[model samples]
Target: MSKLILLFGGLLIACLSLSANAAPLNPLLAPLSALTAKDIAIIANDADPMSLQIADYYQHRRGVPADQMIHIRFNPKTKVLSRLEFAVQKKRVDEKTPAHVQAFVLSWMQPYRVDCMSITTAFATGFDEAFCAKGCELTRKSPYFNSISSLPFRDYGLRPTMMLAGNSFEDVKALIDRGIAADFSQPKGSAYLLKTADKARSSRAVFFPKIAEGFKGVWPVFYMEKEFIKGQDDVMFYFTGLTQVPYINENRYPPGAIADHLTSAGGVLSGSKQMNILDWLKAGATASYGAVVEPCNFPPKFPHPGVLMANYLRGSSLIEAYWKSVGMPGQGVFVGEPLARPFAYPSK
Candidate 1:
């Protein structure tokens, strides 16, 4: 990749040499530390019982300071929120958010979209049509993409947001517990980068060789040319692309594990013709990403495996790593425990 394309917001790509068998290149600037509970603000909707319940559970589990909670009320049964409806509510969140809060945990699942923009992107960048595309075109690029700053909002005026999403209240609770269980307890786990036969979906395979080489001695980066992974017990990170992935339930996803399949409407969270990222979460993965709208097959729209691992293994939280991986995130939703850092050292 050219330096101009890899570069963003005045940050250089640090010589991204992707040639096979080449010396490792630096992909991420090591952040000072992963985001802690205190750095994240919780936004809960009073109208949704599930929203309120999840917020309370997350706050209690993560030890989020009571003052950091921001409450808003809206009918939570709808599938999408219009720009006006979202702007009014977003104002409340931005106004009430504590200055120290660096990121947001949206404690609900519904209203995943604001017009054409995903709600996560809406919250992260506000409702801007510049992020929406008419067809096969580029959208807004995130200033936080592949960035080194641990405090995104403080550094770039962007608060990376994540949803504590699940099929049921119990599922969300388990997700939170997994994140808590993962902190500072870095396990020896495998990072699976599967390159499937589906050419369009597997456009990301071009990035695997360099990722594997860079992470060789530090973490086990397995670049496999398989359609799907099954029966593996040590899975910590898994990335691939497909409309509907199979055998997801067959593998073991350790606590704090992050996985995703790049496909349209995977961010829909439910009722889409394609498989959603929630499948990974339910199958034991801590976090995943998918576009809420049809973002075409642009590799920048999905999580770059290299960027994801580079940040995550360096002790950035799940939200930070996942958000940084995607160059353009206007169409996607990020779901997971925001503060799952399995590889973090306590002293850092």
Candidate 2:
């Protein structure tokens, strides 16, 4: 009878150990305690597919619940490129998607205060060869340049491109807002518009039911740069990284396929405003339709997994710093705060 009791106890311990090992881990915050701010920032904003994976790893490892992660942000660099992130914050604003959304927004706006000289300087050399021949000037004489002459380059939210109206931020924001409100899976058209209206109506109805009711037929319209969407390495990177988790829905691509797409030549080179000119080579002026599928050359796996790991650690550190600076954690991760000064929102 004593031996039988001992055997049962041993089996119980073994079962407990196996069950503990089977539980999933969080990637984002687990690595945080050892990382620096710079590394955290890099990992948070890494262009690799494993960004969110990094985030989740850290969160789970630290025993931080998903609801405790009040905010998130891409690296500072992503904001410079206008790769906007979106999220819906919780009312208490902890460990929710809102923090991630806010962090990305603040990072996206960092370049707004860039110095005029530096902004012009950055573009001057490239513009001379690229646009001077086409009668474009970086000086105040050009209306496009003139509008931003007095402001710092950092103040520029979105750069003017050759789009129908050039770098259209309103168009971009509208599209993102509409997409999120529409739950990301909505098809393009009136369905999205009606969903957007429903959100606004609900919000307004709480305070002004009659007024909200009167505002009917209002619809959301949006436009976005094809290049931004097509060249979205961060999106593919984050989604793929999350897939590394056991059961996350985003893990559709075979383990290495996403990394391949991110570093591919076609993925990297195909989305530039200037590089689009290359497509003309594959087609003619009058040709109606065709597709040029080229690919980029990148490492089969991460060129430096160690460096990638270090950077992710650094980015998480910055996120911690931003929250501390704010005194209270707000929605989304923020490296820094915006100035009180108001800037014009881009409009058509």
Candidate 3:
């Protein structure tokens, strides 16, 4: 019996030693700390009260420095801007922003698209006609994809941007607060990938199996039918299709969760049968993406679930992950908190 006890003690010591020798898990995600207040520039349309208000709220909530706030004068009512008008605005932003500012927060929903390209894409990589020339061809590749550097503009010459857009100032404020809350509280959640009836909109389904495979032990992944998932308090990621709402009332999304639908005019702020991207924010999602113009069934124009999930799982900020997922972002506007990094730290 004493020998057996001695043998057990030896086994316990060996196990502890082996555990101590094992390598620690390196963080695969980028947290909110990756983006400093100095790294972001907030652009506001001085002519628009709502734009200015949202900008002020975001700057305060995110603790963005005073010099990082850039004001530009433009027709705030217009939904689309001509290339020339956009160029002038872009020039102003370039001139006003400090050299170190790596990302932009546009404080309005209108003028989401500049000619054929989304304002966010144009601001990131400048306007490239090739991106809009063909519907089916590949677009310009983003240099910031799967990038390790937080200074995207400095490292890759690309500045990812997101719109602080919503139906009202209160909603925008809530959205910003949610982003901040997410940074403070990193919740355990699941990523839901839906298989909808619409084939064109459901192209992301093909990548669902792979996404499940990738997130096996890291996070729970759900691949379900067209029905809206309900009563889930930990929905960190969701991708789906439809024109109208997709029954989100039943789900409770944590502060950093991302949800978006694939449909024409989901980006359109005005009248459309489809639900607007801002609605996702209203419904608790911290970030979302949509095409302002008619992008047809072009998969490149929309966020690729596989790329988005992979990058997010790798610790990329919401803006970087979403921006990197799209191959052709010329017509799509990214709306949400740009710096929400729920997966930035290692899971406890």
Candidate 4:
């Protein structure tokens, strides 16, 4: 409901909606021209062992074309890259990228942030200050939000990107394995949208009514007012807001399942006080989103549940659904298996 906000005088009036519009609310049950392995370019840090290994494994696993693999050299230890330094390397990446490529998968976890913007955003759309917010103000809006177009790079000159990020080689391999396993495997899964107690962070809940209404017969919609879900055996989509989501590992996330807790700095995969988005991957979720910086509890800074599930159920790939869900993604870092498409079918 980031777009639902309206201001009068000096007051920030919160607007809530129950509109079940078909476009984003009741998405038609149909396959989309999802971002495929061929449409993605893998950006790997050759200097980092983990980056190289993950890139190689993902390439073979997803059948990504040999030419799509992009290798660059950078310091492996730096978690944050300076804007000036990143621009030089990014220019090289831009020159090497094929025009047909629609998105990217950054293989390394470190260097996740470039100045105030997430590395994923930096790589996808270039380092633009319009995407960065100074205070609680809104940043640049993503052109791909709830969009029907599949050719992002060609159309908007923006590549919707994600990261093959995990703690270890095995962890990332397992993550990719889950993605490969999800292809065309439409399992009976449940979508969990928790309206937690955190008022500020729970800003995305405005769209829950419409989302729940749309997924009524298409999927199991579980809209609960709780802090966390535990011991669930089949969680396909779990959305909530909390600083530290407890018992996340106790729930089972099927392949291609998307789960995320809305909080500041969850995208700070390492050395964050909040429960990192990596924990979502470790706990079996195939994809997740978080803010690498302090993106105040504005719904635009996080994934819109309505847009995400609607796009995913309509058969968009994990990366597409996640990227299109966020209105303002400058601060948010998207990390997931790029090609998971459980709900997608082969084009007839």
Q: Report per-prediction Cα RMSD to one decimal.
A: 5.0, 24.5, 9.3, 5.8
Task: Give candidate 1 regions above 4 Å deviation.
Answer: 1-31
The lDDT of model 2 is 0.20
Per-residue accuracy of model 1 over 17-90 as CA lDDT, tens digit each: 22222223243234337889889999999999999999999999889999999999999887899999999999
Q: What is the lDDT of residue 29 in candidate 2?
A: 23
The 10-residue segment of model 3 with minimum total lDDT is 16-25
Residue-pair clashes, model 2: 57
Give the per-residue lDDT digits (tens) of candidate 3, residues 1-348: 122122222222222111113221223332323565668999999999999999988888878999999999999889878989988888998999899888998998787888888778888877777656445555555555433455778887878898888888998888888887777355778889887877877765766765565555556888887647777888888888777656686788998789988887888775467888888888899999887777776666677665566556555678877876776677778999888776566346
Q: How many backbone clashes does candidate 1 have?
A: 0
State the displacement of the C-alpha of residue 81, model 1, in Å, after optimal TM-score superposition.
Answer: 0.6
TM-score of each: 0.91, 0.18, 0.86, 0.92
List residue ranges in candidate 4 displaced over 4 A. Answer: 1-30
- List lDDT for all candidates, in order: 0.83, 0.20, 0.74, 0.83
lDDT per residue (tens digit) for residues 1-348 in model 2:
122122222322222111112211122222223121111111132332333343444344333344433344434333222211221111112232322122222112222211111111122111122211112122211221111111212233221110000022332233223212222121111100011122311221121222122212321122211111222211211111110112213222111111111111211112432222112111111000000121111111111111111212222222222111111110111111111001111122
The TM-score that candidate 2 achieves is 0.18
Candidate 2 ranges beyond 4 A from true positions: 1-102, 106-166, 184-348
